[model samples]
Target: MPSSDDEATADSQHSTPPKKKRKVEDPKDFPSELLSFLSHAVFSNRTLACFAIYTTKEKAALLYKKIMEKYSVTFISRHNSYNHN
Candidate 1:
């Protein structure tokens, strides 16, 4: 027969293990040049916002095409009602 102390140790060993800590990705580690062209503004309404990417017209067209291809036209239009100069 195991002692009470031994039984306690055995019970602890069989119990649930501690959860592992989650690793958060650092935004500073991302390349600066990739985001350098982008600018954003948020409206007081909270639902309204806009993003402007500073690049050549050709690149802008290409990016818009890619976004449109991936997302639905209605979805894009609904969320893109706001513009900031």
Candidate 2:
């Protein structure tokens, strides 16, 4: 009779191999006008996680409006109020 350790090894050898993760493809045709508004951007894989824009308050508001109209997004802002000075 096989020992418990031997049986465990046999079971592991018979188990199916792990599946490979599929690569996420970035968008092929992004809007040019929106691209002009961004000063900096960061993407993780195919997802845009952060971006920045330098412009007048009015222009910033307009950009925000345009983005809201074009995409479904949940905006998150972070602030650190503690000063270490």
Candidate 3:
């Protein structure tokens, strides 16, 4: 015969369900507010670094396109044509 403690353990185990893990987002995956702040800080110093700036939505789209194009290799280029005198 099972003891009272064994019975309690069995009941508890059956009452609770396993928890599902949540997916985490990567920092470099897209343009977050932090990215914007960094962009502002760095580009503010030199206008040339602000040649191309992408919004969060634009960054998401770019990420999707990059994924669909091919996962073999990915290359991101940063070009700044601004001339601050």
Best by TM-score: 2
- Which 10 consecutive residues of model 1 have the lowest summed lDDT? 76-85
Model 1 TM-score on a 0 to 1 scale: 0.28
Tell me which residue pairs clash in candidate 1: none
- Ordered list by lDDT, greatest first: 2, 1, 3
lDDT of all predictions, in order shown? 0.56, 0.61, 0.52
In the range 1-85, model 2's lDDT, one tens digit per residue, is 8999999999999999999999966444444555676645454567665564434445667777787788677883322223332
Q: Which stretches of candidate 3 lie above 4 Å from their native place?
A: 26-85
Cα distance off (Å), candidate 2, residue 45:
15
Q: What lDDT does candidate 2 reach at residue 46?
A: 73
Candidate 3's residue-wise lDDT over 21-45, tens digit each? Answer: 8885544544343355553333344
- All candidates' TM-scores? 0.28, 0.38, 0.26
**1-85, model 1: which lDDT tens digit per residue?**
8899999999999999999999954444334544665444433655333444344445767777787897554543212222332
Name the lDDT of candidate 3: 0.52
TM-score, cand. 2: 0.38
- How far does residue 23 in candidate 2 sit from its true spot (Å)? 1.4
* Global lDDT of model 1: 0.56
